[model samples]
Target: MDEERNGTGTHLSDAQLFALAAPAAGEPEALPAHLSLCRDCARALREWKAAVGAVGEADAGELARRSPEEWRAREDETLEAIRKAGSHRHSIPAWRWALAAAASLVVAVLVLTARRTAPPVAAVAAHATPAVAASSDMSAADAADDRLLRDASYLAGGGDVDSGSGLESRL
Candidate 1:
């Protein structure tokens, strides 16, 4: 930034120049053109841009100075820091992993044991008779339907059913 005085020396701070540039850079109006027209503001903008680049370079150089082992250590530290920053961000605990692995192993063993020790399904099937019946319309009302009552004598006599009350009563 240039703080000019008529035949007198003056100066401007980097902060002031940066402040002036920040607003114009964000604006969508003629302020940007006005910013360029002021050589001091333009120079100040370049200087700020360069300063940022320099800081980034310094950071990169510092990171590059670490040995591979040190780099790994730094990476691990960063990961751990990030993990610690949020309690939920870290990995599962070793004990939890072990428990899960043990559970899986036990499950596998039980499955294998069950496959071998359990009785064969086909053996059970061969001995079991089907329990479901198809039809169930037999009732006294159906049997005593007046139109069919003419056959009541024969029905009461009974061929398939032994009970003297006859088929419907036996059922």
Candidate 2:
């Protein structure tokens, strides 16, 4: 009986007692001998087995008595609970789609405006060439070109003809 201790404690945990109560064939040798000599462990194991059997019987009876309608209702309740607990919403709202479209239109209008206002690649490259000297005629020509480009961009952007620096104001 002393040999059954295996140099560890005399008592067993609930899991160890449960394993001993329902063991597979030809498991470790020492547990049965220990249970026989230990009155406390033997009594605990008996109680554990009885409790497990009673729970199993109750579960079997409950399952046997369940009707199809009751099962469906239970399943629906479980599914509803799962839906409520889920993180994702159903779908994006209409306002979000409208905002996105408005944002896209703003971006497109900005890109078109930028393209229209930007100097042509050829004109930029022309300026890269060294000039002989600063000339008043060249400066005047550059100013006229700038004013034309600005007027063209303002008109293309749908500036009101009846208002703002129109032909009447220029005249």
Candidate 3:
């Protein structure tokens, strides 16, 4: 079937021939004309139809031979195999749990270190305001933006906003 066609007219591929075998409603306009004119295509269509019919007969024969109990037992075995495979697949490894714990510990340590290093936000704001107000070049908006940035950093480090002595302790 794969060999180069030695004849004159173009022939239908295997897929087109199969589609013509079990056509949807009124078959394609050109198919009937092609099948009538092309002997090779007609033969291929017949072969595909025969193969389909043979498969249907085999399925029917198999259903008639197999008892309901035998079918149920096969289904049960397949389900048990799936369940066993799923159980092992769903469980996390010990090393993965250990890795997660280690990551959590590292995060906790970093949080504690930042909290210890940062001075209280009140002292910082007090010293910052005087310096910002004295700067002749600094606009009120720029001073406000600077204060917001410093406050954000202080909050991120978990420092107490109302505690600590003054700028001297921070320095």
User: Judged by lDDT, which candidate is best?
Assistant: 3
Q: Candidate 3's error at 167, in angstroms?
A: 99
lDDT of 3 by residue, 93-142 (tens): 76678999999999999999998999879989998888767666778887
TM-score per model over all chains = 0.26, 0.29, 0.31
In model 1, the Cα lDDT at residue 131 comes to 15
Model 1 agreement with the true structure over 58-162: per-residue lDDT tens digits: 889767467899988989999898878766534457668899999999999999999999778987665442311211444657545532443465665654334
Better of 1 and 2 by TM-score: 2
Question: When superposed on Cα atoms, how far off is each prediction in RMSD?
Answer: 15.6, 11.4, 17.1
Put down candidate 2 lDDT per residue, 71-113, tens digits, no spaces: 9999999999888766245344666788999999999999999
In model 1, what lDDT does residue 10 have? Answer: 37
Error of 1 at 144 (Å): 84
**Candidate 1: C-alpha lDDT:** 0.60
Task: Point to the candidate with the largest TM-score.
Answer: 3
- Count of steric clashes across candidates, in order: 0, 0, 0
The Cα RMSD in angstroms, rounded to one decimal, for candidate 3 relative to the true structure is 17.1
Q: Deviation in angstroms for 136 in model 2?
A: 18
How much lDDT does each candidate structure score? 0.60, 0.69, 0.73
